[model samples]
Target: MSLKGKVALVTGSSRGIGKVIALKLAEEGAKLVINYPVADEAESAQQVVEEIEDLGAEAIALQADVTAMEEVKGMVKEVKQEFDTIDILVNNAGITRDTLLLRMKEEDWDAVLDVNLKGAFNVTKAISRIMMKQRSGRIINISSVVGLMGNAGQSNYAASKAGLIGFTKSVAKELAPRGVTANAIAPGFIETAMTDQLSDKVVEQMLSVIPANSFGQPEDVADTALFLASEGAKYITGEVIRVDGGMTM
Candidate 1:
């Protein structure tokens, strides 16, 4: 196992892309800290923990709103107490409030920014301290292709993701000397509940832009994350790897 005995913390990992990332890390023998935002998601989070345990890997699910600094700090403290070290931190907690700028409400912008951007800020701020002390860590932020190539109805989402890229670069510079690498994965449209809701026509339209002629699976992103979290990528940092299947090419 490439990550045997390592401890990995992936925020908002109860389901979706975050869930897949956590599972992949666990498969590599990394102990998992699966974080969800609220009580309602506890069952789902526990299921992920159970799944990891079934895979013969240790895991615990912690609930913390990534946007809340105090909660984030507490989660970090708890994680340290349990695992003694956090080798990988995946800031995958995010939300989208899509609307054209003219139709966007203040609350919509605030909500998206708080979760997608501020949430990363809060979690990274708290965890980076530990990584700096250890003199080694991997910080992977989940960005989006929309951030690189603007989308008509996703101004807030695009801004948050773009800001995340900038934030990753800055953190990479600050932590490089400590052997910590910070990178962002800008995923294009992946098959998820969000995409499942689209009509066939809409799906075809989306596929048309993707030269691969297909939507990416969550595993594609998860695999990339696994590589980034491994020793193989120790020398790579401050970069954004686009898993867009040529959608933005």
Candidate 2:
């Protein structure tokens, strides 16, 4: 399960699940490029970079808005300058703009789609050229169960995540011949800053429905990401692996 000598780029890795993913990959001996949008806290991103370095894996943090193609291109360039080649890409940067369809603003819808779906597209597209040249790569997109089973007050978020699933399958087919694998992870109710904002009653009610009867930690998602990025998952692609504590079932 070691990724010795491999280089990975994890977007939105400043904190939460993304941060844990980067750390877990580093623990598995992968050099990392941590990407965070301008809106993310710099301290958190830097902390991740330092933590990876402390673990004896090389790591660098780069700021870039994933929704912007040019920014994503620049981010890839920076990563190339640092690691020369990227063997893995984790499209973990995403945002939720939760609102009922009737109340969802155009800006909210566009913003969520732009960052969650288009952002993955921008970063993956930029890195595909390098991966194609190398004839090997792994792409893991962070999707959500809400996308699979529609949730109330999250129309925009659901649409964005659902789009990722379609994009993952399409890209996997396109890159399969090149020895590249693309997949999506649909996580449900992971404990993070984002979920912390949920009302206490909402969280309680949600937990009651989960078979596990508990919320998932960031490491659970990170472990899944690490496996998908490993050699063990080479034969698996164009698929969505749920890390939902059986909630989706």
Candidate 3:
């Protein structure tokens, strides 16, 4: 888990699971680049950077809307200017708009796909070049259990995440020759702001189906990302590792 001298970039790291992933990597000695979507989130992003610095690691926050290619490129250019190389990339920016398939608006589906799937593509495409030149890097995409098992009223979200799995596998194969690896992490029922919005009955129902009988914390997913980025996982690639407490099993 030693990531000393590595420069890791995590998207949507202003808060939630992404923030935790950035912190976990920083704890292992990686210099961090935190990406948030907008100016409104600048404060939160700075806070994450400061926290990483507090851990005695270097960190900087950059703004970029993952759905936009130019912004993604600019963001990567800034990182290259400051760090010279990127050793890791975690695509953790995703959004969900739940609704029955019949009622799911086209905008919702497009929005989810734009951020969850295409965002991964935009950032990974830009960063893979750097990794290829360096001949080493790690890419971890944050997916969800729903992407694997399907969830009612969340067709859009499920589709985007499932697309990410396919993207990760293809990227893995494409980059393997250059010493870069790509993998997906499917998390389940994590107690985040998103899950907190679910009703008590919904939570209870989720717990009933989960073998752990309790929701996972963001750190659980963060630890999994840490493992995939570590030297121990050099042989692992193009795989979707579930951090879901046996929910899909």
> Which candidate leads in lDDT?
3
Clash pairs, candidate 2, are none
Q: Name the lDDT of candidate 1.
A: 0.94
TM-score of 3: 0.99
Residue 129 lDDT in candidate 3: 89
Query: Candidate 3 at residue 111, lDDT?
Result: 94
The lDDT of each candidate is 0.94, 0.93, 0.95
Per-residue lDDT of model 3, residues 127-175, tens digit only: 9989999899999999999999889999999999998999999999999
Lowest summed-lDDT stretch of 10 residues in model 2? Answer: 35-44
Where does model 3 exceed 4 Å of error? Answer: none
Report residue 57 deviation for candidate 2 (angstroms): 0.7
Q: Write the per-residue lDDT of candidate 1 for residues 131-235, one digit (tens) a residue.
A: 999999999999999889878888999999999999999999999999999999999999987567667987888899999988899999999999999999999
Residue 213 Cα positional deviation in candidate 3, in Å, after optimal superposition? 1.0
Residue 163, candidate 3: C-alpha displacement in angstroms: 0.6
Prediction RMSDs, each to the true structure: 1.0, 0.9, 0.7
List, residue by residue over 181-227, the lDDT tens digit for candidate 2: 99999999999999988999999999999999999999999999999
